[model samples]
Target chain A: MAARKPVFNQQVLYDTTPLPDSIPKVKELGATSAPLFSASFFIGTRCKDYNDDYMQCKTENPGKGEFECLKEGRRVTRCARSVIKDLNTSCLEQFRAHWECLDDNNHQLWQCRPAEWNLNRCAFEKLGLEKVIPDQPPQSTPVHLRKKMIFAHYPIPSHAKPFITGQEEAKPKAS
Target chain B: MPQDMPPVGGYEAVQYKRNIPARGFRAGYYLAGAGAIMAYGWYHLIVGLRERNELAREKMWGRIHLIPALQAEEDRDLVRRHLADQAREKALLGENIKVYHSDRYVRPTFAATPGSTTK
Candidate 1:
């Protein structure tokens, strides 16, 4: 058979686009869960390799595992499970950190503040996220007038909420 | 013998036409192509089935072999941990030899089995 090029190698090399959001977020935090592995299956079927290009690194110089890198001189390593576990734990830790940060700043509108959004900035040097408190009167209209304005803009029936409530509370028929 | 009977030469020619090998060659080619296609299909089907069987075997052995071998749930949990450890070692560390397997048909003979042996 004539030598055919592989499907993956045919793509353009240097076409730059914005990186994906998930990868950066994952990297920033780190996981904490136990790694669930499908590496052996990959090795048996897809990769057909015992090299460094595999996702995980070997413990010894050359390991016997499917995902282990082939060393220049030594035995091959074989530990797909541990590598997956590490990855999971790291990801979970990262997620937990991000979650905690967000939880701590429950009232903050902006998550990351770099001490820049102000004119009298020297007086307020504490670099923290801004808190957004809702306006009482809103400086736009009174409660009734605002309600009327909203009703004008988006005209749902006044009794629509009550009707939804009734529908939710409605019981099943006997049959 | 005058009008009803055909000439022997014409009858032989009709027989020769009926006995031509072209039909046999076509049938042979058709059967060969069909066989090749069927074999190709069967080869992939077997491979898929084998892969599934291997996965099922791993699951079964994990439950039957590893679980029962351990005493406590903690020990079983340790084995589960070790399975991941083995997986990681296999993947990253290249330590595939987590266990051993023997050939199905091979049987070992002990020396002098209830009878005289020459040693």
Candidate 2:
């Protein structure tokens, strides 16, 4: 069989789109929580890593059998698996509860709101994520509308504020 | 001749040799069996090695991620500080920075024109 083209040679990096608000935002907790949105992300990223390793191995050892490149490929795969397993182990209880609730509620966000909140709360407290604060008090509105409006008006937390504020503090113009 | 009668001259007894040569047949069977066993063993050896490598990689990566979970409060705090520093440095460098375009706002390029297709 003709040698297959290496995946890395194709400039298609894995999708970097942020997870939709509908799915849980566990990764927002930074490196402490799951590195990516879903367990599948872990698998995909790891697969990419494995492919990279395999390609590198092939380039270095042309005409070698699959067994020759197995060493590096396995290393990458193991690393990815471990990262996923760690995340699961760390937050399995909350993750399970959130998923089960979604399953039970037919994936209706409004119905699973409580479970979602519970999971977020657990992640925030345990994973060192920045807590988002609303700019104004919540208004009396439909649950879905309220959620949308709340996020719309949410301001960055002080701890997580960006270093660059376009308006520099008035320091007398540097002489 | 009556239907049930034996050949008229005599009941001549004839013998036939074995259809297959026993020596060759036995040798072929033995070779085939050995080949099959070797193939099976080779297949399993490859699979076992693959599995072992996977397990090892998993363990290695797991420990890296697990560090945060297993750290003491002070260590965790240090990690958080390190991350904040990294973010600040990146912002300062401003490498490959892209302008943020909010979905709420429509740019001329995005606006639909008469007789034009919307993307």
Candidate 3:
């Protein structure tokens, strides 16, 4: 990527043109950031081999990987899409709840563990995909499974503010 | 002129200092207090640093795990464009023309131009 070959911007033309007939076609995955993060572990579970193969291809072909590794790339995409589809069909409620919580919490996994637990349970039961933190000690609870998250900031309490409105009028004056 | 005449023995030797009876602990005690506070702070700092490092590892692995799927998404687009360019050239020229000197692949350095920048 660092090897510079300058193509001046003004003279360059846009190619609205799409893939030719010779190359096989694949649909792009539609899951956005939070949803993707939510489903990522399951994708890793099912598509580990395909994902590794695609990465290996890219690694072996540094500059030309983008063009040369299209086959492996399609496989990775397909595998991820399958995982997402299976989750949607089998664990829709848990999946949506988890991703929504993640979206609300800036996508911090620990903040959304309750929802994640539900999702993980459903995924494991239905799809047999598990979420495991690689290289973590087997004896200790994973960070996600911990009861308390040290850094998470819980929602601010309305502590100082009155809980009931118009109660001042309802009650007789103290004086 | 009686004048203030030293105002009755210079105002009774006006006590210039705060007579608060050595307000704080001794110097050694202060050092001990400061050292204790610092030790406490350093302990928490190290714990926080280790937690942060662990979190960093988690975040890095999260990104690493996602890379393949992300790459696949990106690669599909690249493949489509490459094939599209090939098709476009063939349509215009009626044959696959070799731009490179040899048959070896050379990566394109520029991004695909968009149809309109404003949109």
| Winning model by lDDT | 3
- What's the C-alpha lDDT at position B85 in model 2? 41
Q: How many clashes in each structure? A: 54, 4, 0
Task: Give the higher-TM-score candidate: 1 or 2.
Answer: 2
Fnat measured on candidate 3: 0.53
Q: Which one wins on TM-score?
A: 3
* Models ranked on TM-score: 3, 2, 1
Candidate 1, A8-49: lDDT as tens digits: 111322112222332121111111111111112211222223
What share of the reference contacts survives in each candidate? 0.00, 0.00, 0.53
Q: RMSDs, each prediction?
A: 28.3, 27.7, 12.5
* Decreasing lDDT order of the candidates: 3, 2, 1
In model 1, state the lDDT of residue A40: 24
TM-score of each: 0.21, 0.23, 0.70
What is candidate 3's lDDT per residue for A56-165, written digit by digit as tens? Answer: 99989887788789889889988999998999999999999989998998888766766777787778768888776687755655665555555767632323222121
CAPRI-style docking class of model 1 based on DockQ: incorrect
Instruction: Name the candidate, 2 or 3, with the larger DockQ value.
Output: 3
Q: How far does residue A150 in candidate 2 sit from its true spot (Å)? A: 19
Candidate 1 fraction of reference contacts recovered: 0.00
